[model samples]
Target: MRSMTLGLLALTLASACGRNTPRPAARADAPPCHCSHDASAPMAANQPLPDTSVFQMGVPWTDQSGRAFDLASLAGSPTVVLMFYGTCQSTCPLLVRDVKRVEAALSPAARARTRFLLVTFDPSTDTPERLSALAAEDHLDLSRWTLLRGADHDIRTFATVLGVQFSRVGPGEYTHSNLITLLDPQGVVATQLEGLQQPVEEFARRIEGYTR
Candidate 1:
């Protein structure tokens, strides 16, 4: 009779143990076990950028308005690009004037379609405040103009791609080749004018062609 009671007690204990044993916790690195769709999650839907475009460099830049963006953000517009230091006394001002001349030559419709980008080699000095001051002094139309500043390495890489050569000739001065580059909507170099002497009308026509 005692052996029968012992057997029944063992069976009851075994059943209780089986029911009470907890499952192991999941590992920290393991992926989530989701059972339902996430409606608020963002979908991966971006197309790959072209390999040859400069925007593919993924360099970060800050503009005169203290807004941060990558070069790819300017991808869809026909850009008039040039590199200059804000404190430059010689060719830099001439370059700005030449770009303005091109802007002046554009019709209102064409001007609205074009974007002017000025990247500074002297990022250390050309902070957003300084760029804003310069823009105000030049009466730059902020609606269509963007002044950019990035790291020194990024500046060098940008100049190299545009075939612009620049060096710090003295304190607060830079000696850079006066070249203006026009980029198509795809960020491909459509045309490059080597000096400030190029006719503004020709440059304007090139930009207009791209807009059309």
Candidate 2:
């Protein structure tokens, strides 16, 4: 009878030990828990740019408003690009007018998707204040227009990339080729018009095509 009682007591202790033991923790390789969308969450990586994009160059630029930006910042929109000095007498005014004409020809929807970039070859004289004054004088639509200036070396490099030739003709004067280039959203050269008074109908059409 004592052996039987001892056996029962041992069985009871084993049960108590089993009840006190904890379960194994969750698996380390378990899937992550789902959560609702959070505006403050970290952003995903940006999409890769095309190989032939001009934004591939790491050139820095400053706008008429004194804001600093790079070519990459202008991505995701069709751009009308031209190089001009702020103080030119002969062809610069005509180039600006041609750009204005192109802008006017764009449909409202296309206009929204289009942007204009004017880079100054004479950065020494075309300070932000001077560019701002020129923009105001020409009644340029500041909302969609950007005037840029950079270091002389960078300006030369950019001109070379665009195949634009320029040489200093006089003090504060430059003789540059009259070329206006249209870049797609990816910064690829889509079309180039080579004259101060070239018809903008085709250029507008190309812009509209890209925007669509």
lDDT of 2 at 126: 97
Candidate 1 weakest lDDT stretch, 10 residues: 31-40
Count the clashes in each prediction.
0, 0
Highest lDDT: give the candidate number: 2
For model 2, residues 42-134, the per-residue Cα lDDT tens digits are 222374556766767889999998999788877777789999998898899999999999999999998987889999999899999999999
Over the stretch 43-133, how does candidate 1's per-residue lDDT look in tens digits?
Answer: 2235354455666788889999889967776666668998999988888888988888889999888789788999999998999999999
Residue 181 lDDT (model 1): 82
Superposition TM-score, candidate 2 onto the true structure: 0.77
TM-scores, each model vs. reference: 0.75, 0.77
In angstroms, how far off is 110's CA in candidate 2? Answer: 0.7
The lDDT, on a scale of 0 to 1, for candidate 2 is 0.81
